[model samples]
Target chain A: MKLVNSTLAALRAVRVNKLRSALTMLGIVLGVSSVTVMMAVGGGASQRIQTEMRNLGANTIVLNSGALKSAGVSKGQGSRPSVTLADAQAIENEVPAVTATSPQHNFAGMQLIYGNANWSTLVTGTTPEYLTIRNWAVSRGRAFDREDVIQGSKVVVLGRTVAEQLFGNQSPVGQEIRVNRVPMTVIGELAAKGQSLAGVDTDDTAVIPISTALNRVVGRNPANPRAISGVIIKVRDGANMASAFSDIRQVVRERHGLLPAQEDDFHLINLTEVMRAKEDSARALGILLAAIASVSLLVGGIGIMNIMLVSVTERIREIGLRLAVGARRSDILGQFLVEATILSLIGGIAGVVLGLGGAVAVERYADLGVVLNGQLSLVAMAFAAGVGIFFGFYPAWKASLLQPVEALRSD
Target chain B: MALVAVSDLTKTYMLGQTAVPALRGISLAIDRGEFVAVMGSSGSGKSTLMNLLGCLDAPSSGTYHLAGQDVLRLSSNKLAAVRNTSVGFVFQQFNLLARATALENVELPMVYAGIGWRERTRRAREVLAQVGLSDREHHRPSQLSGGQQQRVAIARALVNQPLLLLADEPTGALDSVTSDEIMATLVRLNEGGLTVIVVTHDAEVARYARRVIHFKDGRVVSDDLNQNIRAAA
Candidate 1:
């Protein structure tokens, strides 16, 4: 039989039970739509995280002093010795692979006073290299220079949030603000940095040179004078990060006088490793969503098969009439297969539209980065059509194999 | 030469391992352009024999030649081809597709024969006109009267111009007046050189045929020329 004729006949058959056909196709629509929407949302979240990670400086590495409780009782159970200015200088001088190094000393709940106005904020003390390692660019004013650090000048750089809170629209550059009863001149304002996924406010802190912060503002404790919170390092190139990390570890152990068998009291956090972990978690989440959506597709396929079987049973007499008119088994098969495929194709088209609409709405209204990728939509559509073919075959085959005489005899 | 030759044709059913014979060694020959009727009471195997001759079922054991081709030797595809091009069937229930118009129902066989839509439609209209259904071509089976539906079935059967027309109790569901109308249509086609076979228990319906074959207990008890009946008709 001509394919066009058979397809028309199949269409006529489906049209006879319009409500039933639509109900059957509803399952496929839901299945494909859910798959598309979930993929969009999941893919969007991973892309957002990657963008944040890139903005945080791809080559940056964080080093923190590990607690000495597990090392031995003689070392005392207090916070481990901080990474110092000398240690930062040693890494910069001895490690050729190290591009820049900065020691960070953070003080929380610090009150900043500017004449009659005072606001509480976080205070961070570091060298000029801190801006490069952290990927922060000065937005409004110039950053503090090495001259300010050497002279132990009481100078500071305000983050966007701190500047806005204290000075409003007025420029705070070269203006003096007091910190813990010590006055300091603001030399720059950091750029506007958004909050991280971990909910940390990046633009609510103040940056000051480490020398002035330790000696002039927050005086170093007599028991731990040379103490610093942690060290931030930037590598010349990522290709040599592993080698540079081992060299830095050796130098730190030697300077601290730790034996070969002793466990190092410092922890290194490679940003590259953190980025990879985030990517792996995102990938796992995507797979889980895909798997759950696939269950809906499976259920939809089964629904199609079930409805097709009922259709076959209901149309036995019609099948008999066609067979009597000289229809081959393949002709019957083609007719039913065409009906099934049309149902799935219609459902797939509807799903694509609905899924894209859903993604766009969520992205706009909920502030998510959801986006419908074209390739994924195509794959989902193809999979839905394949499901129709796979599940539609058995019922169609059963209809084709029916004996004409017996079918005609059926009431 | 005979258009249909059947010898020692037997068919049996196995109902849970009990062999029940429907037909036992039935031999018959039908010449081209002949109008023959097979008459029997219920359970007399007349319908079984009709089903075999119509190519709707295969005999358990038999050598049946249709148009000089060994019907038993044909493959399923060949058999389907033979059924498509060589045989037309009319059933008691009219068997017209309920969803199709009268013209579309008649065009169905040509669709199976791989005819193009234009030619199928043309031939279907011509046949519908021949059966006096030209004005009702657009009507579905449910919209037509019993007699009209039967005529549509006859038009469908004749669309392929088959070598034989097999009618099984074709008028069983119609009233006497409608039955007469349907029989007259069949008689006119048979007179126009189409071989016709009618299987029925109605003696009055059998009178229209040129010959009569009677069956009892799965075997033919009498086969005779109906000269008186034919002369009267």
Candidate 2:
């Protein structure tokens, strides 16, 4: 009953000064909304990174041909064709930790032509195990078999986006599409994988047999027909990836004949390491935005203090009157404190609603992904409540400390 | 026993190292059911005396026994208790909460006393009716006339059924006509057996009281019963 009276009295006080109270609450509203939106944006970015990491297979490792060195400084990554089919095959044969390895080669800027339509896209050539390594599913028809890979048959699997570009809405599963003047039958279509972290469309590519890419297509350095660009390895479910990576590296070093002092001519890209770096930066950005938002809340709290001080001064006579009429000192304190808390709580509730709307707006109009976190919104509201209490204390104390005689005597 | 008893009650204030004596060694006692008028000009310390008597301020020295209990040594909480249940005060400005209705203003003291809502409202309405403003219970202080506002203040002061109603210049802000009406209300309340103390500089206002105490420089100069008392008419 006491709480109800205080709340009603506080609400009536707020209602008496409608515009002033709204202006005071405005600061809190902006502060809480900013905190919420910042948290959602940060959380959304981190969530997107997690999804991107998942897109890159968790246990898969990429073995790229190492950089070429001219003088002391080395050339950039994938500078040479140091990785080859022999190294990949040796790792698959020698490494006990190895589950499956797929040697991948790519032919970029290839014109895929149908009867009346033509589109430019990249074509990758790999074994059937590449499908399993990359978690690539064929949405339609069947993938090329080992027979096709071994014989270098002209069979292709179009990605969803590439297929759409070449065949429009039509299902081109048995259609013969010419790949740079060479006719290849479309045996399958890969499911849409969306854009990568680097904003590149992963679906804008087609797949074919390795032998078909290295032998039938533009054979680079005919003497090095067995050369491959990279190797994709998928560790078994229960196997440790660290041991598997080391095992693959040891096998490759021996195949390349690298001495103890000589650096291996290949690089291993652990998917998690690359993503951890990205996630760390994302987390740093999140903290920075949260700090900025907290500063805004502090400013909002100051606004509340400013208004409360004015209120205390303006209501000195009223305070004296209450004090004279049997109100204890604590009663005056409770009244003002409850008023401040109510202002902040109202602002916080409105902010949560506004923040959710802001997050959705950012996701839609701003083309950013936002993850609405229920727990985070509640924390923001709790912070607002804390702001109210912290800022409202001083003015209430001053009011409670007023001598009833002097206060009644105030003009 | 006297309802209010004091001995050498003194209050001294410090104005930046200057010892300002608002009240000196002076004491007085008033029996229950007495309508007393305190007359003093500015700087005469009548306001300070009223503040002490109302339990809003404690005396700096000396003893104050209210209703046969030592009140000077009581803690602030105990003082608040005395103020809540024993003494009710009306201010010169009719200091009702500007935003609250006249009914709410009257109920304010009961609210602090932790009274239940139904009873508080019922009693507040009863007091408003007693003050002859039953129809204007919902009017804010601004909406009411000066006399009406003072009546509301009186209703608030009387709602607690205090042993004494202390009024400081209760009619200072009113015209002669409204002042007569407010004085009549106080006379009627006193006739009902509630002790009433009015602080005023106006002789016309003081004539309504059964006894008048004149003070100068914090010392009581005269205390006497009125032989020719002016009725509320």
Candidate 3:
């Protein structure tokens, strides 16, 4: 009952000064709204990164052939194809944490032909484990098997984009297509994978057996006939990835017969680590935005304090009368504190409404994704109320400390 | 036994580094149901005495017993409770919250006393009827006449059923006619067995009291029964 009375009295006081109250609340409104927007934008960016990481495949690492140095001159990655199919097999057999490995040799700008439709795209020569390491699914027919690799079959699996261009609406499975003027049979068509984090079309390339590419299409490198491009390693779930990464590096280094002083001839890329770094930066940006927004909220709290001080001064006689009539010191303090809290709480609610609207507008017109977090909105409101209490205390204390006799004597 | 008893009540306020005595070694007693008037010019310390008696302020050196409780020795919170339940005060300014309705003003004391809303409203309305402002319960102070506002304040003072009603210059701001009307209400309430004390400088206002005490320089000069009591006429 006491709380109800204080609240009612506070609401009446607010009603008495409508315009002033609204202006004071405007600060809190802007503060909370901006906080809401920043949190939502941050959430959206984090979610987008999560989706990109899923598409890139989880718990996987890329082992790229590093620079090959000779005569004090260096050729860039994959130049001399130092990575071989035997190195991939050795890593899979040597590292217990490594579950699967897919060795690949990529030939870009290969012309794919079906009937009169000819489209230029990258052709990847990889083993069957590539499908598992890359999380790629075949939407039609079947994938090339170990038998196809061992026999060096002239068969290919078309990516969605290549399939669309070469076959249009018709299923390309069981059909024959030509890669770089070499005839190959279409064994399967891959499911569509959307754009990568770099905005490259992931479904715009074809896959073939690495043995077929080395023997028939691209031909072998004269220096190392068994040379392959690079290897994709999938680590077992729940195993320590860092340890697995170092273990693979050791295996590769030992196989290359390199000395301890020699620079590593291979480089490792942890896909999740790269994505997490981006996530951390996005989170940092969000914190910075929220910090900036809270400065406005601080200003709003100061405004509440200023108005409450003025109110206390203006109501001296009323305070005296209350004190005279037997109100406890806590009663007077509670009255003003409640008034301030009500003001900011209303402002916080208004801000939530405005901010949600702003988030929708950003999503629509600004082309940004937003995920509204219920917990975050609640925290914003709690913070607003806290701000009110912190700033309202001094003025309320002053009012409560007034002596009844002196207060009653005041005009 | 006296309802209010005080001995050697002295209040000294600090003015810079010097002490200014508002009350100097005053002793007084008033029995229950007595209608007494304290007469004094400005700065004579009658107001300070009333504040001490009403438990609004503690005396610097004094022993005060309201009923049986030691008013001077109680904590500030207890003092507020005594003021709420034992002494009702009315100021010359009416002191009604300008924004509150007459009913709400009367309910203020009960609100502090932690009464339920239904009982507080019922009792407030009863006292408003007693003060002849029952029909104006919904009117704010700004909407009411001065006399009507004072009646609302009186209703507020009466709502808590205090042991004593202390009115400091209750008619100081009213015209002669409204003054007599207010005095008549006090006279009728006193006849009903309520203890009433009015502090004022006006002789006409004192004429309604059964006993009158005069003060000069923070000391009482005379205490006598009124031979020509006005009888609220």
Candidate 4:
């Protein structure tokens, strides 16, 4: 009936059975640790997702020129080049959220010759904004400017991997390389971006002015000189991307004079959607792992109940004495319940410390990202208390229901 | 009204398929501040009657009153409350919580009665001193002698200021010297206006009671008031 008394009594009870109580709490400690660790892993995974999103450019959208249709029969990607340079310009001018747009044309498996040795890689042609839109920095020299792009200068920016292949340890800047019989000066080198989400080596390429590609190689198609391979657009921060996408599509559709009855010649790729799906699945996995880990706490609670029941049986005479001296049934129940709660609570606290230590250790030693979810420790504690309540009740109730006279009669 | 009233009490218990009758038509009354002893051999129903009188149990059929309340029809919870508020009990075993000090043991009944810690400690100290255990207030049951543990139990019983002290074979585990000391404490408590009833088989122990009721075969064989009640000294 008195809370302080019950707590003090519970403390004394736990102290009497110190080893047994600690052993019972070990299960609960494990349960809480599993939950905390799982959540931390989930949190770490979320951080990795953020980095992946950054790598993929969360605000960038790619409108690739493809999905060409002839007599209602659709040709595959890049078969038609309706996404011209003019359409890219129109998207920038008409779409309010379009911060920047870079029209690109690329020839895959192009041979580059420097002296007698030669290397083969993709050659992309684009303006300076291409590097900004793709989050790539120029490692040496400078990015191509408007003069280089507009003057149709025969200059190239080599990706790190391509530079290594063509020039070896030498600085590729100020050097000239022949791209299948057409000579170009290497003005800069792009930084390494490592592996992309598709596990492709993004650095194994080269960049030239778009004017050079249109004028020299892959000169013309059915869409004429204005046609490009694709347009990469950077949407401003805080802009509604979905509406920007629609606005860009509308501008392109109108620029190409496609009617409502016809599908546009290009498809838009919102990179954020892919990143979000990855994040969603990671979150779901976190919850699932935590749920799975929580089952062990119930088992731990069962351990508590088992010990409590044995305790009740062993302390029958004690119970009888308490009852004989004016303790009510609820008093007996409260005492036992308090004991169980204290046991599990100790486990919960230990588990929190263990989980945090494990998280840091995993992150540091395993070289994996680990995040600490502050709420999870609290949740695990509450969970431990819940286990105490759910499992402790029956045994306490059993103790309370004991007949004082019979209990006193027991040895 | 007398401190206790009983008319026509009977108790029957079922053990598996057998109906065992423990108490049959037993009725008795004792006044406030009386020191009485109930005596019988095992299975003679003196223990059963003690349980009923202490509010630890209810009779199968009876009209019983304690301190002006008809307790025969009271629910288990109310019966427990009655035991808490009005009746205190001592056992043959000292029944002290082995983990708790003497003061904490004495404070337990008041704990269940929802007494605050400060007041519980205050009154428990007062009662422990009354039982001549003031110096042993912080001693655990294991740290005390057998007679000292029994005194601590008595101190616990008196903590609630109950109307009756029902002791079942209170000195059964103690030697004669220690038993006399325990009886002397009970007599002193009785002299201070606390009603005390002891159940004992030893005639030497029963000699200290002012009135003795003897039971045989679930019936009272004799009820006698002794003029030369033996003093503990």
Candidate 5:
């Protein structure tokens, strides 16, 4: 028999029971929709983590001093020994792969005053290289130059949030601000960087050259001339990160005069390691979502199989008449399979639309950066078709195997 | 040569553990262009013989030749081919696919024979017009009268232009007037040089045929040419 004619006949047969056919197709719709939605959400989250990782500077590693333990109690419980400027210089000179290093001292809840308008924010003291290594951009005015850092000039760079809060809609360039009763000039303002995946406000911090911070602002202790908070090291290339980290650790150990086999005082954070951990967690979440979505697909396949069985029973007389008139068993099987495929294809098309709409809605309303992948949609459509064929086969086969005489005898 | 030749045809059924013989060593020959009626009371095995002749069932033991080919030795697929190209069937209940229109119903056999849609439609319309149902081509069987449905069935039987027509109780469900119309249509078809075999208990239906065979106790008791009826015609 001609395939087109057979398909038309199958369509007519399905039309005889429109309600049942629609109900059967509902399973496919739900299955495809669930898979698409899950994939969209998971992919969106993965992209978000990757963007945050990029914002943290791909090659930068952060190192902080560890607490010193003495007599079963940490001596630096609330205040660990600071990583001095000497340590930062040592890492830059001794580690061959270390391209740039900046010693940083951060103080939270610091009050900033710009022309009587004050805002409490995070204050950080670092060199000009800190802006590039932290992926920070100067939107207005100019970042502190090498001359300002060398001359110990009191120039400050305001984060977008601090600038906006202290001087709403007005440029804070050349304005004077007081940090811990020390007057500073705002030479630049950081661009608006929204937020990190860890929910930290990237715009809510202020920057100043470390020399000015050490001499004119937060003066260094007279007793410990090199005292500092911590240091951030940027590797020349991503491939050299591990070796640079080992070299920096060895230098720090030697400078601190640590004994052999003793734990180091400072801790190092490799951005790549954090990225890998985040990727592993994201992958696990994606697999869990996919598994849950598979359950929905399985349920939908079962629904299709059940409806097809009922359809076979309802059309037994027609089947018998077709067989009597010379329809081969394969023809009957093909007819049912075509019906199932049509149902699933329609569902897949609808699911793609729904999934993309959902992604767009989440992006707009929930403030999530979502990317609706075309490849995932294609995979979902193919899977829906496969499910239809897989589950549609047995019932159609059973229908084909029925004895024509017995089927004809059925009312 | 005979269109259908049967020798020592036997058919038995097993009801659980008991054996029942439906046809007992029956032998018959039907020539080309012959309108033969097989007449018997209910349970006389006339239906069973019709089934075997129509290729709807196989005989337990027999040598049957259809169109000079040994049908008894043919495989199922070959038998289906022979049935498709050489034989047409009309059941007592009409056996029309209820959902299909009269034209589509007539086109079914050609569809199974893998004819293209355009050709099947053309041939089905031609045969429906031949049965004087050209105006009712789009009507389903339920929408048509009993006589019309039977005409549609007959049109389907003639659609493939088979060598033989096997009809079982063609007028069993129709009134006397409709039955007469159906019988007249059959007589005209047979007169047009198409071979036809009809199974009926009604002697009135049997009188339309030129030859009649009577069955009793799973065997043919009489086979005779209707010379008087032919003379009257």
Candidate 6:
């Protein structure tokens, strides 16, 4: 009965000081909402990384040409001609862990024209195995065949973005689109791959046979006509990525005839390792954001304590009157404690609402994915109540220690 | 047997490093159904003695028995319970909760007594009606006159059906007409077998009581029955 009365009394007191209560609750509201938003953003980022990694294909690695020194200055990766179509074939045949390989030569800034409409896009030339190496599916028609590559056929596979840019809603398959003034027949359209980790569009390019690109389009290089910029390799399932990486490196080095003391002209990128590092950083960022937000909750608790102390001093006569009417010291303590808890709990409930709204706002306006669950909200509420009790203790204790005679005597 | 019995009661106050005696060795007894008024000046120790008798403050060295229970020997919590069920205090300020309704103010003691809501409301209404404030039950203390607020405080004091009603200058804040009205109410309640003790320096207020005790320098100088009780008026 005492608890019930005290709670009611607390609620009444809060209602009486409307502006002060609302201002006090604002701190907690902001803290909880920010915490919720940070956790959601972190969860969303990690999830996106996982999907991007999946799109890159499981147990896949990319081998790009390392720097080449010219006049004592080094050109960056992919700037030198290192790996070739022959090296790709050798790695697949020699390494037991290697499942599929595709040597790629990129022709960027290629203007694609289709009857009055034209768009500038990248054109990647590779063998038929490129589709399999990338786990890319033909959404509209069939992918190019090995016979097409051997015959040096002028056939192309348009990406979802390229197809949409040139054809709008129309199907690009079997249509003729001139690439750099060379008319090529579109064989199929690749499925949309969305954005990459660097925020670049992945579906804004076209794929063609390497023979067609090297022999007819760009002409052959005098040093190594068959040299390619990079090779995409798919390792066998259940094989260790690190071991397969070293084995592929060894095979590439041997095929290139590099001595043991010489530096290799290629670099390997393991998608799994990149994904793990990205996830770790995301988790760390989440903890940092949560830590910063919780400081505001602590500040809010201190604000409540400050107000409760003032209230105790103001209601000295009321406390004395209660004591004279047979209120135990514990009852006085319990009453103030209940008041503080109710303030924070109500703030917490409001914060949960505000936090969910904030998460949605980030997802919509900030263009970041957000993930909010029931468990996070519940934990926030419980923590808010705990903060109330912890900070309200000193003031409630002070109120309880007051002497009835002295308190009643005070004006 | 007396409702209140005190033997050799003494209370001392600490004024920084000095020990000031508020109450010297004093002994008194007031039986049930008696209306007693203790009159004294500002530094006469009448208020300190009243505080001790109401169990609001413990005596420095004394024994106090209220309705056969040793009040000074009880634990703090037990003493609080005794104060709740055995004694009701009415302050000169009419110390009713300003924000609470007259009904709620009357129910405060019963609330502390752990009484259920329905029973508390019932008894609170019963006592408010006794104080002739049934129509003004929902009025807050600020909304009522000084006399009405005092009546509400008295109703609060009587709600737990205490063995003793300790009124410290119950009419000090009221005008002469209102004071008479409040004194008349106390006299009528005393006639109904309630033990009442009013502490005041007003000789006029003291005349309403069946017995008057005068205090000077923490010592009772006189204890005598009133020859002509003002309640007959």
Compute DockQ for each candidate against the true complex: 0.46, 0.58, 0.50, 0.45, 0.28, 0.63
TM for candidate 1 is 0.77
Assess candidate 1 and give its lDDT: 0.83
Q: What TM-score describes the B chain of model 5?
A: 0.96
True contacts kept of each: 0.54, 0.71, 0.65, 0.75, 0.27, 0.71
Tell the DockQ for candidate 1: 0.46
- Candidate 6 CAPRI level: medium
> In angstroms, how far off is A328's CA in candidate 3?
4.4
Ranking by DockQ: 6, 2, 3, 1, 4, 5
Give the alpha carbon lDDT tens digit for every residue of A235-291 in model 2. 777688788888888888888889989988899977766888999998998899779
lDDT of 6 by residue, A240-356 (tens): 999999999999899888999998988889877887787688778777766766676666556655654565566777888899999998788777778778878888888888988
lDDT: worst 10-residue window of model 5 chain A: A74-83
Candidate 4 TM-score to native: 0.69
Compose the digit string of candidate 4's lDDT tens values, residues B13-66.
Answer: 899999999998888988998999999998999889988898766688878999
Q: TM-scores for chain A, candidates in order?
A: 0.75, 0.84, 0.73, 0.66, 0.83, 0.83
- Quote model 2's TM-score: 0.85
Better of 3 and 5 by TM-score: 5
Model 4: which docking level applies?
Answer: acceptable
Two-way lDDT contest, 4 vs 6, winner: 6
Give the 10-residue window scoring lowest on summed lDDT in candidate 6 chain A: A303-312
Model 1 per-residue lDDT at B182: 89
Model 5 misses residue A292 by how many Å? Answer: 2.5
Native-vs-model 5 lDDT?
0.81
Candidate 3 per-residue lDDT, tens place, A322-377, comes to: 88899888788778778888887898899888889988999899877788875776
Docking class of 2: medium
| Residue range A164-260, candidate 5, lDDT tens digits | 9999999999888898778988999998887888878889999888887777666675545577778888888646778877888889999988899
